[model samples]
Target: MTVAEGVRPEVDARSLSDADVLAIRADFPILADEGLVYLDTGATSQKPRAVLDAERQYLEHENAAVHRGAHRLAAEATERFEDARATVAGFIGADEDEVCWTGNATGALNTIAYAIGNASAGRGGREADRFRLGPGDEIVTTELEHHANLIPWQELAARTGATLRFVPIDDSGALRMAEAARIIGPATRIVAFSHVSNVLGGVLPVDELVALARDAGALTVLDACQSVPHLPFDVRALGVDFAAFSGHKMLGPTGIGALYGRRELLNALPPFLHGGSMITTVTMERAEYLPAPQRFEAGTQPVAQAVGLAAAVRYLEGIGMARVAAHEAQLGARLAKGIAAIDGVRLLGPAPGEPRIGLASFVVEGVHAHDVGQFLDDRGIAVRVGHHCTQPLHRRLGITASTRASAGVYTTRQEIDLLLDGVRDAVGFFGVRA
Candidate 1:
């Protein structure tokens, strides 16, 4: 199933073979190392050769400041940068003008949060009033959010006189929709949440939540760092006013991410970072700004990283996102079942046989997460340990930390089996009664 250039393969998700999976693994150089079982893709993915080459070629041949100079190199660089934007926009079902580049997803999220805060302080004139928040207003999120998603809203609430609220999660780590209905009401001005839980691997009901927010006359913000890589996502279809995702988590470079916003809203929002490349007319006193994306992207951008991210999108497109989702779902079931069979292991997120992405987090009885991680590492299996940047969720689950194993397109069933084997060994090594 070798993908043709500029052509997406028509692949049946359920029909993918071990040979097909193994063939795709060759495109990632890190997978070639037999001693390493890289299963921490929920944190960040390994870059494929296509993505690496795209970035390297841009840096070596077309390195120049985009949208600034009148030289040939500058023209080429600008063209490539805008082309990358278009690629990312098309990938997420958004217009090119709606996508804004930032340092990372956290940066993108902060850009939106701070811009709204500025609006509350009377920035961007009357058009920005839609984003304004005060004492009577409320912001809604979830307890399952990563720190990046949680902290920004907390600060936003503090800056404004608005109150911050969260939807509680059930014992099974699923969002309590009934509680959400009660929390999100007339006073709610903004609804922010993750499309997928990074620690628990639980998929959220975006459509239902978006509808609730829409009915409440609230703006919706989606944290798509986990979903964008593993799922078939369309921001427009999801009906979120703003969505943020990181390039590094999706097989591209670090220090680059994108925010997808409604063009009208973006144009109305105040600029976050100010300096060069975002001005329309500058004078000694005040500077006029550009439109939507250019308005938000104030400084020099991540040129090579954007190119690599575009290449990564093309790679995923070649594989077909539906197939990618299906592949991960299949692996998720195996992982869930394997973990459930272990005596002392308590799997988080949805119960066994329930739908989830290809990841699992667990706590082993009488053994700390660090011990579990070390045992796995000794057996040449790489897994993520600690709170996974969701300390609040861990606290809710009545644990301080957890061990997580996340799969990527390059992951194999053998690697998952090894993880299970290592966990069983760790339980016995710790002399747990169970």
Candidate 2:
């Protein structure tokens, strides 16, 4: 548990013990509450003490309008804000200028989608022509996408007169890459997909999909909300044109997220919002804007939240991402196997033995998902139910809703067993027929 200076820890990620997890859990105050078994990290994670302390420290001592004044407090606030930006950029292997702050991952995705829409309207002149779309052009995505990744593209396509298509999922709820190859052809202008499915917890083949988009001369957008927290992510290594992720999902504060774009592409795209800070010059009839990160971040920024996110980034780095991925993978396999063994329970996404994160969504025959959630809740086990903001994916899987239980760094095998026990009791209580 002691990390050495200037040396990355070499602990075996898959061999993390229950004591190791429990020790980590001690850093989060909420986890100390009795009778609380939190298993819904896919929605949002519990914040660690470090992140909370950072935010509180910033608010108490460095509270000021960043980049808007020349006072001492303002300078300190601006330095802290930009320092946070640098920390987050390093975490994702991106440049500080390439990272644009937004309200959340949904806002980040919408910024990209709206910027492209602006380009289609001839806003950025020749530099933005690459992003333009019109009749006969297609935007490709996958059916496994969460609604945040889906709706913006749908709106963009509607605005630009482009067709929106998706690669369908197979019977196992996995994306059919063959269909992707057929759909992402010469006519495709852009391709967007999730690095890891929020509902399914299955990691998609990002390299293959990015290659397909590249070969077709289309822009790539990665929804990295799920992957950034659970995997060893490098945005530069992934080579996508743009990516989006949230702070709250990674043990940071809410109301803050980042959109990472390639510098050249970001320079070409028009601003999604207009206000006080983003502008370079302005007149009664004309206005010019600043470059990338600043261009997208209009008005006041989330100063304290950014500082908190940087602390979260440092905390994860202290533990090492390799270990986080390995621990989650081990627990994911355990959850999948245990769920599959239950009668009248249908687990969604990749079958047992498949590579997945620590999450499982399932339906209980003869019992609604809400009822199952309530049953678990009564037993002091927390889980998410319903469509999980993935109505299309659920419809494709032939269900209206499902119950989801997800884990994080602090989760242990004993907690997984409790969840399984809760599921079994719920099934028996409902008197489900064989």
Q: Name the candidate that leads on lDDT.
A: 2
Q: Which ten residues in a row have the lowest lDDT in candidate 2?
A: 1-10
Off by over 4 Å in 2: 1-14
- Tens digit of per-residue lDDT, candidate 2, span 1-434: 22212225454455567877887888889999879999999999999888998999999999999989999999999999999999999999999999999999999999999999999999988999999999999999999899999999999999999999999999898889988999999999899999999888899999999999999999999999999998999987898999999999999999999999999999999999999888889999989999988999899899999999998998888778888898999889999999999999998888899999999899999799999999999999999999988899999999999999999988989999999999988889999865
TM-score of 2: 0.98
Each candidate's lDDT (Cα)? 0.91, 0.92
CA-RMSD of model 2: 1.6
Cα lDDT, model 2, residue 422? 95
Error of 1 at 193 (Å): 0.4
